[model samples]
Target: MTKQQVNKVVLAYSGGLDTSAIVPWLKENYNCEVVAFVADVGQGADELAGVEEKAIASGASSCYVVDLKAQLVNDVIVPTLKTGALYEGQYLLGTAVARPVIAAAQVEIARKVGADALAHGCTGKGNDQVRFEAAFAALAPDLQVIAPWREWHLTSRPQLLAYLEERGIPCSASITKIYSRDANLWHISTEGGELEDPWNAPSSQVWCWTTEPEQAPDTAEHLSLSFHQGEWVGLNGEAIDPVSAIDTLNQIAGAHGVGRLDMVENRLVGMKSRGCYETPAGAVLYAALQGLESLVLDRSSQDYRIRLGHEFAQLLYDGRWFTPLREVMQVAAEKLAEPLTGEVVLKLYKGQITLTQKQSPNSLYSSAFATFDEDDVYHQHHAEGFIRLYSLASRIRALQQASATDPQSGGTS
Candidate 1:
C-alpha cells in the first residue's frame, strides 16, 4: 500500500489501546510526525491523567490537551437538548453529540500545528469512524484523513496489545478488559462482552456509573428543577450553571439508579448493537424540560415538536451537526423553547425518574374552563356547535350515503 505524502498528522488520542498504538503506527507506516490532540470533554481526571506523557512515549512528537467541557455542554449538549433529540427514541446521544465538537477541535489543532493530515483510531465497523471522518470532511477537506483501523493489520484487542509490545510501546490495556466503555459528563456507555448477545441480560458487572436498581435506597429522592427557554437554570431553587447542574444531578440521580438503560440500538453504520447506558443527569434534565414544554406549548405546537425531535435525533445520530439543516432545526427549536420557562419536580426511585409536578407562568391550563364544576366562564351548549362543525365532513358523507340508499328520496338506479 502506497501511503499518501504527508509531513505531519494530528490524531484524536484518548490514551487508549487503539489510539496509543495508532500514534506509533502512523509514525511507522506513514513516516509522518504524529501530534496527539486530546479533547477534555469531561471524561474525567483518571482518563486524562498521564495522557500527554503516554502520547509522547508512544512515539508522538507532541500532544495538545484542549479543555472542551464547557464547549461540549454549552454548544453541543444543550443545543441538542433544546431540540429534545433522543436517538432511536431512547438513547440520549451522549456519544453522538460529542463527536462534531471533538472533531472540529482536532481539525483546529491540526491546522495550528501546520499538519497536512488528520488521523483517528476509530474502527471501520463502528459509527464513530463515520462521525469523525464526516466532521473532518466538513471542517478540513484539504487535509488528508488517515484512519489506522482501516489500514492496520491488527484486528483485535489482543492483536493491538501484541503489536504495541512488539514495538516496545508502553500500553496499560490488557486482554482481560472485556467491556468497551465511553464516559463523559453526559453519560457512560458499556458495550462488548456479554452485552453483545441480546438474549443475555446485563450482569452487575456491566453497570459502572449507577447503582443496581434492586440495591437502591428504599426511600425516594425528590428534586426541583427550573428551566428557562429549554435549558436547566436552577436546582432546588438555587441558581446553577449548566456544567454544575449536570454534575450535581449525575451524583444525585446515579445514587438512586434513576437513569440506566439496557437495549439493542441501531447504529448508523447499518448494524444493531446491544449496550448499557447510564445518563443520570440527562434523564432528569429531559424529564424536567418535557414537563415545562407540556405546560407552555399548545397541542399542535407540541405535536410539531415531537416530529422535529425525531428528525433532530436522526440528524445528530448520523453525525450531520455541521450541516445547514441542523442550524434551521435548532432555530425552530429555540423559537419553540422561548415560552418553555417553568419549574418541575421529579421523583427518583429504583431506577425510575417521574415528573411529579409541573408549573409555568405561561401555562395554558385554565382550571375554570377544564373543571367539571359549574362555571360561568365556559358555556356547555357552545360545545354542541363546535362538535357539529368539527365532524361536519363525516356528517355530510353519512347523509349522502343514506340518500343514495333510499330509492324514494333519490332515484340512483
Candidate 2:
C-alpha cells in the first residue's frame, strides 16, 4: 500500500497516552500538521485541564476545545432517553451515545482549520473505531480518515508510554493503570483489568463513581420528577435544563446506590466483553419515564414503543446514529412521547429505583372504571360478550378439533 498525501490532519485528542503518542506519530508517519480537537461533554475539569498545552508539547500545531455539553445532553441524550434505549437490557449506552457528538465536533474543527485528514485513537478491535469512521463518512466523506492503532506496531500501554518518552513527549500514563473508563454527564463505564475475565468478581477498585450498594444509605430517598412530552422539564417542581437535571440527579442518585450494573455483552465486532457501569441519573430517569408512560400511553401503544425501543437500542449500539433509519426511529419515538406529560415520585435505595407514585393529565388509568368494588362507570356483565368475541377463533378451533376426534359426529379423520 502507498501512503497518500496529507497536508494537515485533525486528530481527536484526549490528552491520554494513546492520543499523546499519536500526535507525534501522525506527524512522523504522514509528515503532516496535526491539530488536536477535544469535545467537552462534561467529562469534568480534571480531564480538560492543560489539555491544550499537552497537545502542543506532544507535537500538535494547535488545539481546539469545544464545549459540547449542551448539545450532548439535549441533542443526543434526551432524544435517546425518549426512545428508552438500553443496550442488552442493562447498559445505558453512555459511551456509545457520546461518540457521534465527538466525531461530528472533530469534523467541524477539521473543516474550520482547513485540514485535509481526520484521525482518532480508537483501536481496530473496539466499537469506537466504527462509530467515529461512520460519522466521518456521513458528515465529511471527502476528508481522509486515519486510524493509527490499525497501522501502528505498538500494542500495550507500556509501549505507548515508551513511544512518547522516546520522542521527548511527556505522558502521565503508567502500566499500573487498571481500568479503561469513559465518563460524561449521563454515566460512567469501567472495563479492562480483571473485567477481562467473566468469572472474576469486580473488585472495589473497579468502581469509582458510585458507592457500593451494601454501603449505601440505610434510609430510602424520594425524588419527585416532572416531565412534559417525555422530556424531564422539572426537578421537584423547579424547572431545569438538561445538563443541570442530569448533574443534579447523578449526585442525588449516586449516594443512594441507585444505578450499578455488571454484565457480559456481545459487541458489534463479534466479541463478548464484560463491563461495569454506573448510570445513577439514567436509572432514575428511566424509571420515572416508564412510570409516567404507564399512566399516559395505552396498552397497544406502550407495547409498540417497547418493540421500537429494542430496535433503537440495536441501531445506537451499532453506530447507525447518522443514518436515515435512526432519524425515522427518533421521530417515531418523539410522536409516541407527545402525551407523556406527567409527574412521578420514585424511591431510591440499595442500587434500585422504585416508582411509588405517578399521575398524568392524559392518563388512561381510571379509578372509576378499575375499582374492584361496584362502580357506575364500568359494567361487569358486558365483559361476557367481549370475552366470547375475543375468543371466537379459539372457540371455532376447539369445536373443529372435537368434531375431528368424534366418529359419531361424522367428522373427517
| Top-TM-score candidate index | 2
Task: Give model 2's TM-score versus the native structure.
Answer: 0.98
Candidate 1, residues 313-388, lDDT tens digits: the string is: 9998898988999999999999999988889999999999888899999999878878987788878888899999
lDDT of each: 0.89, 0.90
Provide TM-scores for the models: 0.97, 0.98
- Give per-residue CA lDDT, model 2, range 51-124, as digits (tens): 99999999999999999999898888899999989888888898998998999999989989999999999999
Colliding pairs, model 1: none
Question: Residue 42 lDDT in model 2?
Answer: 87
State in Å the error of residue 92, model 2. 0.8
Residue 362, candidate 2: how far off, in angstroms? 0.9
